[model samples]
Target: MSKFLLSALFGAAVALSSSAFAADQTLAEFHADMGGCESCHADGASASADGAFEFEQCQSCHGSLAEMDDKHKAHDGMMMCQDCHVTHEMNVGQKPTCDACHDDGRQ
Candidate 1:
């Protein structure tokens, strides 16, 4: 009985380790498959209904770009738009400063 319990424990550990490794491998492959923002963001072919600029289509490559602060401010909740569309050149990969958008309070 003791031997059986030990074997089961070891088997469980091995299974867990294998699962973790598989997950890591998948993440690595995903990272490897990722391309630069310009790969899709640029060109008139990528334009959407929300104007010629958008980033929702970029979640697969760029992930999330929202921010939270001590004031409990969260852009994710307030705006469905991406920062690159309203503030900077999405394909150029240049991030704009806060003042760029907040200057006129239009953002």
Candidate 2:
């Protein structure tokens, strides 16, 4: 292969590898960005300690799930709270809209 082709392949490989690594992010990394462990793990409780996430805890900050669900009823089944919000620091505005998957003009 020509040097140019080899370099292009190397660049593409690196990009793909980096994306893969990003997809495997640890919760700790998310905690760091979204605020320290206590931000979500209130009262010194550990999320890993129980392996459970109480949606109620989030509702304390983000509002009731029922209300949010009502607002998002149109995109139901397309995504869930975790699909877009991996952490408490998630900016809802940046989350993918229903159009991302429902953009086939089926609506």
Candidate 3:
């Protein structure tokens, strides 16, 4: 291939990759759009002290672990937020249901 054609292809590839990266928002962005950082951070300035926003942190706002346990007791509470909300972007309808992770035989 000509040098010019090769350069064009490389440029296009870079642009596509960068756009994909940009599409994923940062944690701070999610906090701003959703609510005050304290909702998840506990103390925004000292987040590390509290803990990184993992499944437990998400549970604070979405629902209590106990609530989930009660609701999903039949399924043995074998689901996690990540199973549905694949990314922090968290769009509705993008999430999967119990059936997605559980077997068809599950009650």
Candidate 4:
């Protein structure tokens, strides 16, 4: 292959690999990077007082709870996405646990 073609392929590969989780990036930071907090907020100015707008934004991107796996569907109508999936408090690859709410001691 030509040197130019090889370099282009290498660049594309690097871009795709970097699309995965960033070691120290929080979910909130990831979302903010996409289009700023406004991507999840109403106008990038502030979070909703009741979080209703932010909740809608989450659903718009990730789909509604009823559309997710059983772990998420189980909480449909009971809580907002932030209740368990705290992006601001969680890292990109981290997931929320029942311990955040449930106390049955099941790990």
The numbered model that scores best in lDDT is 4
Candidate 2 lDDT tens digits, 1-107: 45874575577557656764343445445434444566456554555444335334454444544457564664354544554465544442345455545667642
Please state the error at residue 3 of candidate 1 in Å.
40
lDDT of 2 at 76: 54
Q: Estimate each model's TM-score.
A: 0.34, 0.36, 0.37, 0.76
The CA-based lDDT of model 1 is what?
A: 0.43
Give the number of the best model, judged by TM-score.
4
Encode model 1's per-residue lDDT on 1-107: one tens digit a residue.
35864575577557656764333233223222343334345552444566324455444334444543422244555554444244222322234345654776543
Please state the error at residue 102 of candidate 3 in Å.
2.5
Give lDDT tens digits, candidate 3, residues 9-80.
Answer: 577558656764333465445444445565455555444442436456666544644566544444335555
Pairs clashing in candidate 1?
none
Overall local distance difference test of candidate 3:
0.51
What 10-residue stretch in candidate 4 is worst by lDDT? 4-13
Error of 3 at 49 (Å): 16
By lDDT, rank the candidates, best first.
4, 3, 2, 1
RMSD of 4: 8.2
Q: Tell me each candidate's RMSD, in Å, in order.
A: 14.1, 14.9, 15.4, 8.2
Error of 2 at 85 (Å): 1.8
